[model samples]
Target chain A: MVERWPIVGMGAICSLGSTARETFDALCAGRSGLAPIRGFTTDWYTSDSLFEIDDRDDSKDRPGRATGFLLSVIAEALTDAGLSDDLGDVPVLVGTGLRELRSVELWRGSGAAVTPAELHFGAAVRSRFGAWDTHTFSNACSASLYALSLATDLLSAGEADTVVVAGTDSITESMFGVADRVQSIPPDAVRPFDRERRGTILGEGAAAVVLRREPGTGGSPRGWVRGVEVNCDAHHPTAPEAGSIAGAMRAAHQRAGVTPADIDLVMLHGTGTIANDLGEALAMREVYGEDLARPVCTAMKSMTGHTSGASGLHSLITALQSMDAGRVVPVPTLEKPIDEMSGFRLAREQAVPVDARLAQINAFGFGGINAVTVVEGNR
Target chain B: MSEQLFVTGIGVALPGADHRDAVLDPQVPEPVDPAARIGRKGLRYKDRATQLALVAAYEALRDAGLLSDPDDAKSHVAVDASSVAVIAASNYGNLDSVAATIDTIQQDRSTRLVSPINTPNLSSNVIASEAAIRYGLRGPNLTVCNGSTGGLDALRWAGSLLRAGRAEHVLVVAVEPDNDVVRSFAGTPRALDGAVAMVLGPARDEVDTKRPPQAVLSATQRAATIDDLLPRLGVDLTAVDGWYGPGGAAEHGLIGQVRPIELGHDWGTPSSVLGLLQCVHAAARFAAGATGTLLAVCGDPADGVYCGTLVEAPRQASRALTAAGHDAHR
Candidate 1:
């Protein structure tokens, strides 16, 4: 069996809340962060709705918004983990679909004085935390989970005792515009697994977790990451394949030395798109078959919006918090769920009470990149 | 836990290097035409970096005897397609595509003019995923866009995958295109317009018993500085014949008398592909009959340094030495 890494600390900044605890509480309360886009003018686009974080504190308005978000989240995670601000030789692994693309967009459009080096978080991370090494993964939406997998490998390979895995992304005009153009009609909000779901809305924020080989002085670890498996469909660029995703899920379970019956909760990569929901639902069926209802499924995007690369850690943090509270966060916007998920016990409307122990989080991205991570709660 | 990993094949889509032998030549040649090297059939919508990666990947696969024909879609390797993985490293793989899409949006004030077919390239993993899709490699595919240490990090991950029995063979490709979009961000005097690829597999593989290995990867490590890295290598530096890394290896007082062959100074600034280029050059030197141990290290003081040791395979070493003697006599 693979060695399990402990997640000692976690911090999340999203539309729902500015901290992981706040986000979890808000999720349990079934509060949605979806609102009309206020960062930019969506006059020419079909969708004006997005899950944008309120950055009212102008002091947080760094050159790169995403970098600022990441730094803040990292600080919180470090504080939570009882780590010093100076990381010494510790490595930082950051995952993002578009690293500072929004900053680049601003520079290109308005001729902002942002240098090319600012396009990535390397300089920013080094300057702020004095990390010795930083690795950035741009694996689309599944980026963070991939980073998490690499962090696990680093720990297992004796490369490092502790690794900080972070994922952050702000909505870029190009991505927002593409989403607006692709969706013929704009949906009111992100509705995962809903019968009338149109597509995912772009969200902005960051999430981070501190993983250590041994549980350090950070009280009790939030959860233990058993295994993380990443694979590609190699079939399509945008559309996800059920067989490939199912294969990844099975591989993850095998690596974790567990079976589908052992999983008590599942965090679905339900993007609310027609293809994504169907593809995920099909893969879930292939894995659990008739016993799909045993694992209580939940989709965090319905409340957090699609944070893109950060969604995986967002979902992971939510899962751990739910396990601690003995409740499954609901998809407040999911009403009249899709028929493909008919047999699955998808949490909806109200947080469901359960004795959740082990949870599986799914993060699928464009280019058919899929990452499945199985985590066991310490509670 | 360091298993026996061998460099079975080496390929380069470098400028002025038509064959693997010329990869180490200092003279810069004319720009490489990816269409001529590979094919133009799937060139549309692919950025220059992806195209270069394809050319290098094709050559590496063929060199490793994994592919019978580059044009044949049904060409199969002895191993299952699902058992092969592809790992690519690039800092700005999709910069051009992203710039174009954003430019179109800025000009038209909408994304209606952007081509949907090119949208997938916006994701950085597209470089590695496209290679997997083209070659039908269904195993774990990853693209490392980290800082300068990305290439060595890719190698480390490949080793981890192999040790864990996740993949039988891994195709590692590192590319950097010297285009306007890249130049704008690279801020380097010369950005490398090339791609380096190598096929890494277990030394005890059953399928290729007859083939002589290129070199055996002895160890790989990442540390905050050269001082921290040398002791971790676990290899005797006095017996090491050559070193391929930054210029300050001798100053570190660990490399002994071996003058470091700095790749960045010889070649252009390769950024993320620097570490892989170092390995490629070391492999070439080994293939040319240079004996003993060769070390390839890259990365900066800020991002830490990554180093790997390559040792000559026993059988290949004898053959290479004999060939070198024969060439010397002639």
Candidate 2:
């Protein structure tokens, strides 16, 4: 028998807004968060623009040089879920492919003493809440999505009544340096699924979702996390293998007792890279079949860019808000509705009305680590 | 709601030797010192990762009674490939490589050589790949990288796979080799080099089913933070044990009567293998009803903590007879 899982609370901070409500409003109005990069010294770096978070007031109050934009996004998620005041010492799982690479660079460049990213993150969370068991995972880009999978397992095993799952990564000069070295960072704005798409524009943000056995005392919940699956390609650390990516998605769908056809929408990892988008499209086609009119798919990364480790959770928040609002958020810019090379359907323009009860989110990171999470509406 | 998890096999490679009897006997082998020629003789040919895993996998397979049919390694999946994750807490990644790499760069930028020893040995995943190739394992492979929590996290991951029916026999290995970075950073507390391998499967034997069972693992753990759990378990971070230098830090008293062997006692450095050694020792003692209860608490000092307890049970004596039944099938 399937267990009845309930959504207690949710939170997020993305390019569109600092608060969950604000982000949801933007999503409803089909607002975009992408713009020219101005947060850091980009001339000395690689990419010219990114999904930087600097509008928020507290974003300026960050103590260190490499501001963990994701932490603020997590704070927003906690507040939205009514968990800001009362976290109640629950276990916290945070995933990031890059654990404060920016901070590490700042320390390296300035020669200033800095706290290790892992300890600093834990200390900050514990101070906000009480002492809680914490785990930080860095599995390339699949980090945060893998965190979600771990949280689900913990909750299913009854290890915790409530588990807070968060994924955050900041865009810094060092991130660009690495991306530039690898030739993965884009030259301009993101264009996922487009024929002219080049590469992923690095983005920064954080997201946290409070998962509990029952609805929290705080009132109504948005949606509950259902099934999540993770797998390593072990094929190539940098490039993803289509077979394994498809296997991961299938594993999650099977575990959830759902099918590819049952999915209402798909939140593509859509890193804006030609290889990544092509790999995802091939995987989706293999899993979902040749039916042209299948699940409505959209790439949120076009607006938010790739939020590094936080991209999974960042897109999840946007997808969840859409589920809550009963609409599908449109793409930031889809110049062409049907790219000749694209095999799946893509959504464009303002928010569209759709009945996608079940959806999937893909987060594939460096090292060929792939994590797929299947989210469903109340059946 | 309780699921039955069984200890079908175990592997261990320690300072003393790579045999189950040698590892569990508590009789220190003649060449116990790390610096002695006898110990250093093999250090040149084998990478520290290979030595640690080979010894641990041998002991585990012996304890599991899979030595006769080494190719019949179908029952277990390795949870981590990290040296620390697979072997011991102290012998994490090699520190000498880090020191040398940094030293070379500092001394002469263009003259430094980036050796293979400096590359693969520094990362923990090499051990997993090596073990897989050595044992011919093709099942689900994962390397838990949650710092100190790697050991327990590996166990948890194995448990999930077994419960989910993903694998019939899951081999959970935690190995750590001696490293230089850890030594300079914190003086290598109870650090030692060793590997602990366990075969996790469905509880079958009478001892596993009995109350106060041998190695009773509560999948549904109590929700407690790392800070609170450590204090409750009485884990003394200050007064170390097993290691030679100063000899202050100690494992939780819950793991009663381990008869720890201070490997390389003269060097004032204890082998990081003590934790795995102690775990195997306590589990064996508990199974034999020599101890009332024993607990192996694994966690990352920075984050997650997992606690596992083993209780005394006399019914496990029948395991020898059951071993024959499985042997006949092969």
Complex DockQ per candidate? 0.34, 0.12
Q: How well is each residue in B1-330 modelled by candidate 2, as lDDT tens digits?
A: 434345666665555544434443544533323223123432343456545664465446445543445444332333331111121222243334434433443344322233433333332244544444444443344444444445554565566666545465555676655555444432454344556677665565554433222353323121244334433333333221221111213433222224323222322233323334444555555554453333344433344334332222334433212211121111
- After superposition, candidate 1 runs with Cα above 4 Å error: A56-62, A113-117, B26-28, B68-78, B204-209, B247-256, B262-267, B301-330
Q: Which predicted model would earn the best lDDT? A: 1
Give the Å error, residue B222, model 1.
Answer: 2.9
lDDT of 1 by residue, B1-330 (tens): 444467877788887775566765645667879888776878788888988998888888877878846455335455687788889998767777777878887688776887777777777778888888787788878887766777877887788778667788999999988877677666666677889888898663455676666777754665667666666565456656667665323333336675566443345667777777777776677667676666677676544445454444435442212212111111
Q: Name the TM-score of candidate 1.
A: 0.91
